[model samples]
Target: MIKTLIIDEETVNVLSYASIKPLWFTDYQIPLSLEQRIKRVQISDKLFLISEKTTSESKLLVIKVNSNGIFSELDNKDKSIAFDRVITIALSQFGESISPGKGWGRYVSGKKLSIYATKRTQKNKNRLYFDTSPIDTNHIFAYALDSNNNGFENIEVDESLFLDSVTLIDEAINSSWQNTVEADDKTQYGIELTEDLYRSFGECLNFEQWYENKLTNEQRSFVDKSYDEPVRLKGAAGTGKTLALAVKILKDAYRFETEKKQKRLLFVTHSFVTAQLVEDMLNSMDSEMNWKFLEHVKIKIVSLYDLAQELLNYNLKKFTPISKDGKEGRKLQFEILEEVLTKKLLEAKFKVGVLGKCGDNFKSAMESKESRKPLLLEILNEFACVLDAENIVMGSDNGDKYLTSSRENWQMHLPTEHERRAVLELHMGFRKYLKDLNVLSMDQMIADLNRYLMSHEWNHICEDEGYDGVFVDELHCFTRPERMVFHELFRLNKSFETKKLPLFMAYDIKQSVDDNFICTVKKGSGSALINSTNVGKTNLVELTQVFRYTPEIAKFLSDLDGSFPALDLASEWSELTLKTNTPSGAIPKLSLYSDPVDLIDNVFKLASRQARSLSGKKTVAILCSNFDLFEEYLIAGRIKKYYEPISSRDDVTKLGRLKGKCIFSMPEYVAGLQFDMVYLINLDKVEVDEDNPSCGAYRRFVSRVYLGASRAKEELHISACESRQGYSPILQPALSSNSLLMS
Candidate 1:
């Protein structure tokens, strides 16, 4: 009773491995067997093949079983088992490879064959079942036989049964910050604004409408709507956690304190730039009523890192900062809880290098600032030689060697060594801050980062000297190794801080790039925080009613996203790409040269055409990573080039949003929002040829490539530097894809 099942398009002519072999039996060993019977297999509880998949449309399943009634008597008390388990399978001969069915349908489904599904026996009854997955469609077909048995020579099976794969990934094109979601629709659970407060917030909302005609995307509405006790916001990347927290701060700012005679609530956050931005936006609003909190101004701001930094810097009267490491040290030592953190950063010149050709895809995972593999690869060939060097790598056990010798070299243990410890400590601090604020887990991490930032540590330092609470912004960067120091801060039962503990913090937790959790005073209580919200999922909220973009662009970008891989999209959700509605205009352009010169030339031509006008006030943006490349395009003047360098922090503030005329060659972090014109470079990574002389650095530039391409408004024309086409398609789904938008 061997079972076998196959599924494909209902309308298509499904062909078997026709004319290969008839039904017969033989022992395992493929060289002797015919050409068609060999298929891929996996063994487990009740072996199954990862053969079938489901798209947005339909699902396909393939199964296999023995002809000796091996599956017929199975006692499947569990409802999870499917009916296909009892069918018999027929086998044929397969050559070295099997042909896969092709179409523009969803994806590449698993092709499965045999599996080692052991039998389960019940009292006085023979039973059989496929013990592998009955859910999550990557796998199809189940079996209890070792695929190599070759017992059957004459069997018939379809060659193209299952096909297609769908995964979640980022397919977004980055845009300026001002590109906002409209406020036409309120959030799923928006908090009510009181009479006076409502008047003020409504006034600000009106101002936002007048200024940008849009609202921020709907943040997960837990803390945003309800203010009770102990709520926390947390999530990775563009999940809108920070936006939620920001909204919470504004809504809550004047709500309390004024109702009772309590002190005004303060905002704690990460940096002055962020604070300045928030304050600026808040000031731009017009209030409808005579709101005491807004009029009296109870809300203040601060940074936790600045407080600690000041402690070390002044030492009551301290001074310093010459080098980057030296500058990084003051913050690292405090976050690491080390009185003096001493470890010289490996010198840029003497650094050891290994794994010369692995490329940048590997670098994204590195936790360290420096990488030696690139440096190592440079020295191998005289032309590729970065410098003369002796390279050696050791195996994990230290009992082995790779190419050269030096058991457990620095290159081997470098990336995660320092930063992991440091960041973990800060992570714990964030948890403690949330607990103290009574905002334990309701909100996501990104929201937690924002709430932490709007703490009163920065703007309201004077108020906090004698104040009862502590709040800080940019907690991740300021509070290195968050899990460690914050754990102690979270201690309850015993009074660790009779006066106060400096636990307030805010950060872009999504961008922290790690999954560090807050240590709990109570274990189960901590567990609750882990899955408080659907952290990794997109479409967690209803954004359709909130969407502000043109309907077509919104739909196009989101639709294009389904084509990209899941991993890439998971890394970046903030940026979404949509070509602009602005008609073609000649604005001066800059050749941001992350790509090669030819790409610069071509895009330069395209941009110059749009940037230049007869008036000659042509201001175009030629964005580049480094300053030297910016000049190269400026000097070439290929397409009416306008070169505006962002050398200072102040210049960064006005780069994209600057009025009158200007060209912007901005960095990745500062590219979004405020920019009227933006042209990104290298949307996708092009494969490099081994024969090419420049294949050397191609591996090192992956991250810069991802960060660089995301900065654009409207038109996204990727200029492929190399001849290679096709990049891992990045996902940027249309907002309308979610029925919530339509609703």
Candidate 2:
């Protein structure tokens, strides 16, 4: 029995739907492109095509399969059934165009029938394949308003009236029938009854079937939860913050479409690679939705730098990005600063300022004896934090007062007034240099954007329809300058009355890759980095449910947790209580090797052997603090032949294909990914000194190690050469607590 169908004109006879089942129909003459017709097949099988040259006296061409056992008037010798029929009975019973829900007299003894149409032929309609296949008995009836303004409700009719009612209609009187056939796929023509027909007609539809896997209850709650005010979701690594953000954007897009409102979403992250991963995961969830209008929903997933470029229109005539990778950018600025500093300090005899506090001379300070290049590079690296902080701080005010006030808050030492002046001079010189060259560094770009937003041009963004919500993943990694960009964007609020916006951020301060990148808006801090006083207040929500880690791994991570003396740990650090089982896997292991080379070799061997044995499909990841050493091992062991290096910017969509192979990754990139087994190497690289100011640095190091340790689903292997750098003091507790199988 055929129940429903679609048809079109121009009518190439594609017999893609020849089976005896509950059939549905559409017009063959309907306006649909070739690509759309192929996609339409995924939901609907049958098509009902009407002829172009039909008249009141014209005959009909009916094409069906011989196995359906319907047209006895047509011989089944050649496998396909084709016949002509009169229109009088069908036209009178079902209306002008022949369709389901009405009678086809004397066909299959009044058994149900359905007719559908296609604009184009999917396959050769003349050739029919026979089958002894069982027939579908279920009937589905669904309706959506047809934009054609036709009298009949566009409903999926039952397959009972069996006259292959190839109907002929009066063309002059039924001219509207031709218009219905040529209407575009836009909803104004009619609501697309495809999904509803596929579901209600045959089986009860589950719109959420695409989300059946991946998210846990807590993650889903965060994705679906609604908030009138801004929110910050904090969680440790592997707690699905990134995935939840993507899901939330998808749900928001869906809701916007359902409500007939424009959808605009802005998702900001730290790395281009991470942004790509979010895009891939979102595309995976619903491949059927029209991605053509992705921008209509304002679905933008971009790195912070990319967002800056976009807002600036990427016109080099406007502002060129500093070519820091070459001789032009910060490198040139460093050289200029070195020359000026060296001359000034030489004049002061490597001065002690007026206070006679001594500092290093420019030449000795700029060059590292070991590398023979500039040690200025190392100092400048440290200076970057102050530079960024000052740039953002100066955004609100001039550099003099902000620079004076922020000197004490910097990461590096500038004890003397001369050294502080030198730092400010270097900053002024760099700003002048960039101004002359029409260029800006990343931080400078953000500062410029902040300034631009303060002008009248920003009124367009404020008044126009922008993002309904803003989601920032890896929020902890944002520096003050980068966060200033967020602040400026949020300031352009759509809700002018309350001056409030819908913003959501996800971060784990414990998973802060660099302590320098930490948000300055701590618990008792009078000021907010993003300028929202609601920071760490009721707007903050912590996700404590750990979905990725096993109980064994969770137990180990909890033991390694350290108190952040500066932070309100209770708010920023979400505790992990494992939500999964251990499932009798290997206890976490500590493998000590004789040397670094031996350690790398053994780790690769172990990962390869595990790849073959652990279900033959388990993934292995090697996490380390050193990327230089990771690359060396990859070349020495030919590890690239066996596995992929995922620490760099590449299409993350290809990661799934490389599963069961050992992937090398930096600890920072492991934020939202997992593996069956994880090897945390170079443990000795992190020195956990309890007595120094670097105790905070040690906590940051421990946090990175804990992130890697918790990535393992079944096994975790930690390797170090005690002879080289000695076992880390931080790992001593896990080593002695009987939680690790130390060898």
- In model 2, what is the error at residue 191, expressed in angstroms? 38
lDDT of 1 at 183: 23
lDDT of each: 0.30, 0.49
- TM-score per model over all chains: 0.40, 0.61
Model 1 lDDT per residue over 1-743, tens place = 21343332110011221111111111111121211222112222111112122123322234443353233333333211222122211111111001111110101112323322222233322222231222434333333332233322222232222121111101010111111222234411111111110011223463334324443333434323432222333332223333344444544555554565344444444333344344434543423322323653355443322323232332112122111111122222233222111121232211113212223433332223333334222111111010011111122332122223332211222243232222222233433443443322211222233333334443344333332222333433322222222312221302332323323233332232111221111232322221222111111222222122233333333454343222221322333333333344332222224346666666655555565541223234545543345546556654444444443222343332222334545343342222324455543333323244223233223223333333333333333333334232232122235311211
The alpha-carbon lDDT assigned to residue 417 of candidate 1 equals: 21
lDDT per residue as tens, model 2, 535-599: 23336555665656676677677656632334543334444544453355676888888777788
Best by TM-score: 2
- Local lDDT at 159 for model 2: 28
lDDT of 2 at 307: 67
